[model samples]
Target: MNRIEKRLEELKQENKKAFITYTTAGLPDLQTTAKLIFAQEEAGADILEIGVPFSDPVADGPVIQNASYQAIQKGATLTKIFDMVEGVRKEKCEVPIVFMMYYNTVYHYGLEAFVTRCIECGVDGLIIPDLPFEEQGELKAVLAKNEASPILIQLVSPVSKQRVPMLLENARGFVYCVSQMGVTGKGANFHKDIREYLAAVKKESAIPVMVGFGIRTAKDIEPFEDIVDGAIVGSNLLRILEESNYSVDAVKEYVSGFKKELNENK
Candidate 1:
């Protein structure tokens, strides 16, 4: 199993929920990106999702959009992002890392080439937001060709209830249960029936199920504690960095605080 699979399975066995963190690559420069990766790992993040900045980040809200734009402006290309991952791996950060990118980014990079690079970079999984469930066959084939290739992570939402089973048919790593129907951002209002949705997902998914999208605070995780395996915090982390003037120290402080709250659930 890849790192993501092994890590999530370990959490499940330990009766501990995952506390995942996502940040855009090359944000304020790749140096800071590398630092952020290690900081989050040091602070008890179970898994790390590194976002590859695309020209049009449709799934991202303002916080990530602005951060991505600045990243691209500072030359955050796929090659450089992969290099950052390789560097982080060399530093002995064993936490599983997943790449969150658009299908277009992977397409232009060539399917075989992309998967090969992912294996080389030590990425454990992929979350391609725009990739349709029905259209994942080609990518899946490429991934299967390599033993160490990163797994494709599936996403389920309240609106996709009817298709949850289909979307999760051959899901690897863990299932990403989108907490809301909208784009990624921080908000108190998740789906009205999020608890039910999460329950349904748990019933349908054979692998671990994690909730994301609007998850902002530690308290948000409490609601899903019984229903899901983990909570993924996104946009608000960028807000923390911005508020702290992009300090990696602040990111560690924030993740450390949230992890402390997560441990209390057990």
Candidate 2:
């Protein structure tokens, strides 16, 4: 199995939910980003989603947008991010790393080249928020060439309920189940029908169903219970890193608390 599948299966065997953490690569700077990546893994994060800073992050909220802007100003190129991943790998961090980026970034980098670099840098999956299922064919081709290649993760949005079966069928790695309809940030109240939506996704998904977008705290994780296999926290973690001036200690403390919250049911 690929890293993503292996990690999730391991979690399943242990009867534990995953705590996936997202942060923009080269935020503050690449050096700090490298430190944060390792720190998150050390602090109980099951997986890592390192975002490629884009010129226009349409799917991102205020916190991630600001972090992206800072990363751009600090010369956060895709090449630099790859180097950071390689650096982390050299230290023997076996945790799965996934890149959360836009389609344009992959297109600009050349799809084949991008996928090759992902394999080289030890990235296990991709989460292109804007890449529709219909258009994933090209990238999927490259991913199929290698058994351990980075898989293009599938997404299940509120409006895509009708397509859940098809989406799950085509899914690799895990299913990214969006928590709400809005951009990525702290969401106070989920839609009343969220439980039903998650239930449908769980029924159809052959792989783990991981909820993202607006998952901020332990309270946010409580409602997911058996509905989801994991949670992805992006904006709130970015906000915490910014607030802590990119302190690794701050990231570790936050992740420790978040993991505690996630495992309370276990």
Candidate 3:
């Protein structure tokens, strides 16, 4: 199993929920972004989802879109993000890093080339939002050959019950279960349907299911603790990074609060 799969399995065995933290790469600056990642680890983040900014982020909301623009303005690219991961590895950090990017960036870099770079840089997995199951053949082959798992995003709507099985079929890393029907950062409450959605996904997927989008606080995640394996807080965390005065200690403390909440429930 890849690092992502192994981590999820270990979390499952330990009866704990995984804390997946998201941050835009090269936001503010590359060095600062790296510091933020390390701060996340210090705050007890189980896995790091490094956001690769793209020009047209259709899946994202205002917060992430703004983050992407800021990172792009700072010249964050696939190459720079990989270098950041390499720098982190050089520092001897073992936390699993997954590149959360749009499909266009991968296309621009070439799927095989990107996969090769990820393996070399020690990227544990990938989360490409725009790449659908039908079009993932070549990239999937490349990932399998390199032993890099691609975590598929499972967007669960009211009509998604029938589609859940197909989404779970070839998914290796944990399934990114989108919490709501809309784009990222909408901040919707977890309704009764979310429980039904989780049950449906769990019935179809053997791997762990992690919910993201609109999840802001530990309270937002409490409802999912019984059904899903983890919660991904993106916009709220990114907002913290954006508003903070570049205090790594403050960031660490903020993340530790969320981590503590997740652990306390476990």
RMSD of 3: 1.7
TM-score of 1: 0.97
Model 3 alpha-carbon drift over 4 Å, by segment: 148-158
lDDT of 3 by residue, 1-266 (tens): 66777877888899988889888898889999888888888778889989999998888899999999988998988898899899998998778888888888888899788878887788887787777767878777777774454444444454577778887776677888887776888886554588888878877887888888888877786765788888888888888877876679877987898878877856
* Candidate 1 ranges beyond 4 A from true positions: none
Worst 10 residues of 2 by lDDT: 186-195
TM-score of every candidate relative to the true structure: 0.97, 0.97, 0.94
| Candidate 2 all-Cα RMSD | 1.1
Provide C-alpha RMSD values for all models, in order. 1.0, 1.1, 1.7
Residue range 1-266, candidate 2, lDDT tens digits? 78888888999999988999999998789998889988998999999999999989989889998889888998999998999899889999888999999999999999888888888889998999888888888988888887768888888888888989888886878899888887889574576788889999998888998888998886785776768888889988988988889999999999989988888878
lDDT of 3 at 66: 95
lDDT over C-alpha atoms for residue 68 of model 1: 90
